[model samples]
Target: MKAATAVAVVVAVAVTLGMVATLAEAGDNNRVFQPCADAKIQRGDGFTFGIAFSTRESFFFNQTQLSPCDRRLSLASGANAQLALFRPKVDEISLLTVNTTSYPAVTNGGFMVAFAGRKYAARSLPAFVSNSSYTVTSFTLVLEFQKGTLQNLYWKRDGCASCSGKSNFVCLNKQECAIKTSNCKSANQGGSVDCSIGIQLAFSGTDKHDAVLNSWYEVSNLQQYSLYGLYSNLRNSLTSQYNKIF
Candidate 1:
């Protein structure tokens, strides 16, 4: 599988990680690193989520989702469910920039956010792109997923970010990511443009990356915790951005 798909698969596993959120965040990133490790968390704390893409015809898709966002955005197939979480501890990180160069090296808690392709490119408010200067786009966050075994983690949503290019080029820095518009294109709306939903962050750090990953099991259980955090972070990001724009 391609790197994006592999990581996207990681996002799909969030379903299982729902039960493992408590295990992953009991105290540090170290606790939730094992692939088979259980989150021991509960539903509504660390689960998956879905966001609709903008109306097709938004020109922002060109630089964001890596696809066209000019069509009838599909619904996030499994989005009916989502986890509920509060803010994450992103302020502590030295360089939380989501760039092509940095995203590959992210670790601890970066790689879990994604969106649908048929509708929005990465279908979140903060990440949406627009061509019009005044047509500022914002985020629209949904609820969080329930914590439990990832029984429903592997299915595609109705309006999921299609794996056509299977990669989103947009990246966000901790500081500017909040203000950043989801619209990558100059036009706020376009036609047949696909939404985007892919890795928000990823890392390859050692066990010492954070207070969470002290144990080897933490490293091994990557999918469980990472998936929960990914969607959780996305919802937070979108909510924050929506408040800012409105």
Candidate 2:
């Protein structure tokens, strides 16, 4: 009887430890993917642009979640969402120079602010490339605010293999075309293209909130213009501004 009781006690202790370990693992995962809950915006505050590769056609649409643009773009914790305007070749033209009169206002606590048009790039390259075609396939930009502490910023880009109505013909990035011989056969198919970047915002006002904005652009060909380079320049400029403001 004594031996059985000792075995039972040992088993119970092991089971409790195992449960604790499982809970700890779950907590760690949550911390890593923390969902943005408090992020909100008014309807006209957010806009999206979609472009078709074949026809080089584009269309703009505004979010229809009613006024106050209280829709949430991200469910991940510790994140906020806003609309941004992205220009690929920013060095040639300044984002700040654009007319703000056309921009829509974003409301916060009865205060409205316009979504500033900004530049973003994935990497750095020459400001100009001769004898190359420049086309803007698709573009998306976002602005977000995080209350309290500022943390790391993240961005992602996804591509469709049949974007151009051809199988595996449209390469999203320069690396994708280089990897496959078939993809590189045509200049339109395999060119280093498609890039994105994110910027961290500085803390201001009584809100104690930090802002972040990210932009992504898709080009059918990378050899034409260095979209990544343009994006990089924009990122650097915005980062400098945040440094100065914060």
Candidate 3:
């Protein structure tokens, strides 16, 4: 009986490793990772982008706070229900703005960058505090490409440009314009404030055609939510099956 039990354990471990290897090998094909179907995009084309949110402490990678492209890695404590994704048509230098869904409350908040492939994820950014002191609402995401393939994603600060003249805002280190969380809180104990984060998207470098790309745009005209549902469904399905193997 002991030998049989040992054999069973070994088989289980082998199966788990095999599953992980299979998933990793298939990672690039995952819709959540490559939503454009590996289509060659150019100026005037659109692609899906990802924003992963979690506690500030979880944003670190190798001691650097940057975004992670792997959804599994970006998850906080193995799961983060608060992920924002969008598809923007970037044709010219413009500002693409996106606001995340509201959270019930915040203790420590931050965000990591993610994009169309498994290879790209910028450093994470901190947005909220545990004391509810302030929240950084405005941000810029710069997409850098090398000869049409994406290479890196960067976070840019506005030096408090938008927060200027706002009574409820503050500037950190002459950059990072932040809104006071105190004003966001309601008198009710359950009131949620400073929960939303806004990000602006911009592009640089060239597409496959080597055409100079635009910088920013608004998220109003972009596609969202629907594709995310499909992504979530696929992810859940895979996870459910994997868990059952145990």
lDDT of each: 0.24, 0.20, 0.43
For candidate 1, lDDT tens digit of each residue in 87-149? 121111110112111111111111122232222123233233222221112121221122222
Each model's TM-score? 0.22, 0.20, 0.58
Report the poorest 10 consecutive residues by lDDT, candidate 1: 88-97
lDDT tens digits, residues 1-246, model 3?
Answer: 111111111110001111211222322322333332233456655555555445655556667654444333434443432444445553432233223223423223443444445444333345543245665654556677655666666676556654467565578779676655554433322333322333445677787779877553332234321122232232332212222332
lDDT, residue 195, model 2: 15
lDDT of 3: 0.43
User: Model 1 TM-score?
Assistant: 0.22
How many clashes show up in model 3?
Answer: 13
Candidate 2 residue runs with Cα over 4 Å from true position:
1-131, 148-155, 162-169, 174-246
- Model 3 weakest 10-residue run by lDDT: 6-15
Q: Which has the greatest TM-score? A: 3
RMSD of 1: 16.9
